[model samples]
Target: MIEVVSLIDAAPPRVFDLELDMDVHAGSLPGSQETATTSTGRRQLALGDEVTFHARHLGLNWQMTSRISAYEPPYHFVDEQVRGPFRALRHEHHFEDLGDGGTRMTDRMSIHAPLGPLGAMVTRLLLAPYLSRLLRQRAIHIKRLAENVDRRR
Candidate 1:
């Protein structure tokens, strides 16, 4: 499990809403080339909503289907993989109100590689760093957008 924490200078509700915005999530990771394969295109995700993403990574096309398994308003949500490249993937987003128009956001990802010991080795040596970078990049993107501009405006 990898935990990435971020502080965004925005109200908890705003941060939480942005976190579930499909467009913001997709746009933040340009390198992944991820796109929603659903008919709704860019839409907000709610509890029990399943989204399939098609992405090109490592010069290979990959697909992952994730469903919003748990949701708590203005607080936290969890998305879990139904089928994907990874053996198992669970992403949890947690938020805390700082009482001064700021939010403390925490993203925790629990991912399991497919090939047992060999896959674990590969994950540790390669996938871990790449995923970590992507996670930090996404956090920064959210922070900037929340602090500087509102994309929904």
Candidate 2:
């Protein structure tokens, strides 16, 4: 189980707006590259939307497809693995209105390793710490972008 919580200095709608644009959100993350909409357009990120991602992590290339299982405007969204390296992967994202022009965002995820006991051992020894740092860095980047960078046109 992996959980992370972050507060952004923007309203729920603003934070949600950033998330709704999959391409932009994905590009903002460090080491993430070459994001594009699949043959599936408009249906790209709504509930039931299926998106494919190709990324490199730890010097290894990874390709995976994720489906949006839950979506509620300005509130929450969830994506689960339709196909990925993990035996199981589920990520939930939540947004709460902070009233003072801010949004509190939370991410909860559970990932089951692939190689049974060996996978669990590797996760406990290496993967967890690395993933935690990556997630925290992403949160910090989002906060800076949401609070200081204005994307409204």
Candidate 3:
């Protein structure tokens, strides 16, 4: 399993609001370039809602569909892999109100490599560290966006 965590300064509601907007949130990722190929039907995300991600990872084109397994407004949301390269993936998005008009946002993800031990070995040797750096960069970008965007408040 591989894990990454980040804290963002923003109100919980604001953070949740931004996260529910899949397109907007995906666009904020550092190395991710995502476009909505299919409509989710509703404007706001809810449990069971399906979102598609067309992304370029490590210069490879990839398509993934994620299903919302849990959703709690102003608190957290969880998305599970419906289809992707990973054998298993569970991503949790959480927000804690700092009480001073700021929120602490966290993202925790656990992934199992698709190729079993061999994949795990490869990830440990190559992907894990790179992914950590990527996630950190993404966190910084998110923090800057949330702080600078007028609508975030």
Stretches > 4 Å off in candidate 1:
38-42, 149-153
Q: Which stretches of candidate 2 lie over 4 Å from their true place?
A: 34-36, 42-44, 149-153
lDDT of 3 by residue, 1-153 (tens): 445555666667866887777556576664667654434666467788887778787888878778889988879899898888778778888888888767777777776777888988977887677666665666666677677767533
Give lDDT for model 1: 0.86
Cα lDDT, all candidates: 0.86, 0.77, 0.73
lDDT of 1 at 29: 87
Better of 2 and 3 by lDDT: 2
lDDT of 1 by residue, 32-144 (tens): 88887543564888888888988787788989999999999899999999988999989999999999889999999978899999999988888887777788898998898
> In terms of lDDT, which candidate is strongest?
1
Residue 114 local lDDT, model 2: 92
User: What is the lDDT, from 0 to 100, of the residue 10 in candidate 2?
Assistant: 88
Write model 2 residue lDDT over 21-100, tens digit each, in one string.
66655766657563645436752367887887677777787777888889998899998888878787788889999888
Colliding residue pairs in candidate 3: 10-103
TM-score of every candidate relative to the true structure: 0.91, 0.87, 0.83
lDDT of 3 at 141: 64
Clashing pairs in 1: none
Task: Please give the range of 10 consecutive residues that has the lowest summed lDDT in model 3.
Answer: 35-44
